[model samples]
Target: MKNFKEKFKLKLAENNYKFTRQREIIVETILENENWHFNAEDLFAAVKEKDSEIGMATIYRTLELLEKLDLIHILDFNDDSRVYELYLKDHHHHHLICKGCGKLVEFSDQGIDYFEKELEDKYDFSIDEHKLRFYGYCGDCRDK
Candidate 1:
């Protein structure tokens, strides 16, 4: 948390954005759960549980700012709702999305790295980062 706080402060300074209590709370809420993906309403709800003074608009603005700062990434799983995940250096992974219950499972495979290289060789386009989402029903939903 101390590391993230320093990085967060440095990032805000880099962008000429002020580091306020509200922003710290938002970032802390995200850092608390490293793996969970959050939409605007969900993040606002979580932050509100911690500090009710935060507003929905502030959450949205902060999320947008984070995205712009390359500190976070937005994901869309073919649903209208958007989700956010923090960008950790070299910790790339993919998602398995349940269409029925809207659950997400994260996974990583080494073969994907090779496949990206193949793509780069075949198409001559350098691959920066990639996101893959496989949509299906989860076990509980499938059993129902």
Candidate 2:
């Protein structure tokens, strides 16, 4: 967590933005729930518990800044809400969406390499990153 704070500090310095207390609280809350994906309202609720003085607009702005800094990722699952997750290179993964209950599961595999290569060769395009999601019922929902 300390490492991420330092990284955030450096990113702020690089972008000529001062890291304020409200931003700190937002980042801290995000770091605390690193494994969980949340939208602005969910994040605001968690952060509000820590610092009631923080405002919703501050959370939104901080989320934008963090995403711009490439410190986090915003995911859309074809829903009205957007979810955010930590952008760690080591933890790169895709999502499996449960159509039954809207559950999201993280998955990683090397099989995408061959598929990516095929697309690149076919379209003569260079792909830097990819976001793939498979929609299906999760194990718990499958039996239901």
Candidate 3:
């Protein structure tokens, strides 16, 4: 977490933004809940438990900054709201979303490299990144 904080501070400095206390609290909350797939509202709720003075505007702004700095990834599961995850390059994974209950599951990217390579060769294009999401009903919802 210290390493992430330092990197985030440096990135903020590079972008001419100050790493304020509110931002620090927000970042800390995010780092602490590394497995959480959250939106601004979710983040606001979590951050409020730590510092109630943090406003929704601040949360949104900090989220925007993090996304712009490539420190987080914004996921659009077509659910009318965005979710966020830390952008760990080495831990890249895709999502399996349950449309019935809005549950999100992360799955490994085992076979994706081969598919990406094939697509790159076929299209003669260099792929920098990709996002894959499969939406369906989870077991509980499917049985209903």
Candidate 4:
């Protein structure tokens, strides 16, 4: 928690932005709950518990700023809402989404990486980044 707070402070300072109490609460919430894939409304509710004066607009704007700074990732799964996760530096992976229960699983496979590299080489193009989401029924949903 301390490390996250320090990093947040540094990031704010580097960007010449002031570290407000609301921003601190938001950052702390995101850092502490690493597994939660939250939407802006959900995050607003969570942060409101810490500081009731924080508005939803503030949360949305803060999330956009954080995304711009590469501090978090914004995921769009063809759903009505967008989800966010903390950008775990140096940890690259894709998501396996359960369409039935809306559960998301993270996975990294060397075979996928090799395939991507080979495709890029064959096409004579440089692959910078990609987002792969496999949607299927989870085990529990399938059993049911």
Q: Give the better candidate number (3 or 4) by TM-score.
A: 3
lDDT of 3 at 34: 55
TM per candidate comes to: 0.92, 0.88, 0.92, 0.87
Q: 1-144, model 4: which lDDT tens digit per residue? A: 576578778888999989988888899887767675788887888888889999988998899888887778889899888989877666778999998888889889989999999999999999888888899999999999
Model 4 residue 111 CA deviation in Å:
1.5
Give candidate 2 misplaced runs (Cα > 4 Å).
Answer: 118-124
Per-residue C-alpha lDDT of model 3 across residues 1-144, encoded as one tens digit per residue = 688889999999998999899999999999888575888898999999999999999999999999999998889877689999988777878889999989889998658989999999999999998888899999999999
- Candidate 3 runs further than 4 Å off: none
If both were scored by TM-score, which would come out higher, candidate 1 or candidate 4?
1
Candidate 1 local lDDT, 12-64, one digit each (tens): 99889999999999999988875758788878888999999999989999999
- Roughly what TM-score does model 1 have, to 2 decimal places? 0.92
Whole-model Cα lDDT per candidate?
A: 0.87, 0.89, 0.90, 0.85
Model 2 CA lDDT for position 25: 88
Q: How many pairs collide in each candidate, listed in order?
A: 0, 0, 0, 0
Q: Write the per-residue lDDT of candidate 2 for residues 1-144, one digit (tens) a residue.
A: 788889999999999999899999898888888466878998999999999999999998999999999998889888888888888877768899999988888988888878899999999999989898999999989998
Ranking by TM-score: 3, 1, 2, 4
**What TM-score does candidate 4 get on C-alpha atoms?**
0.87
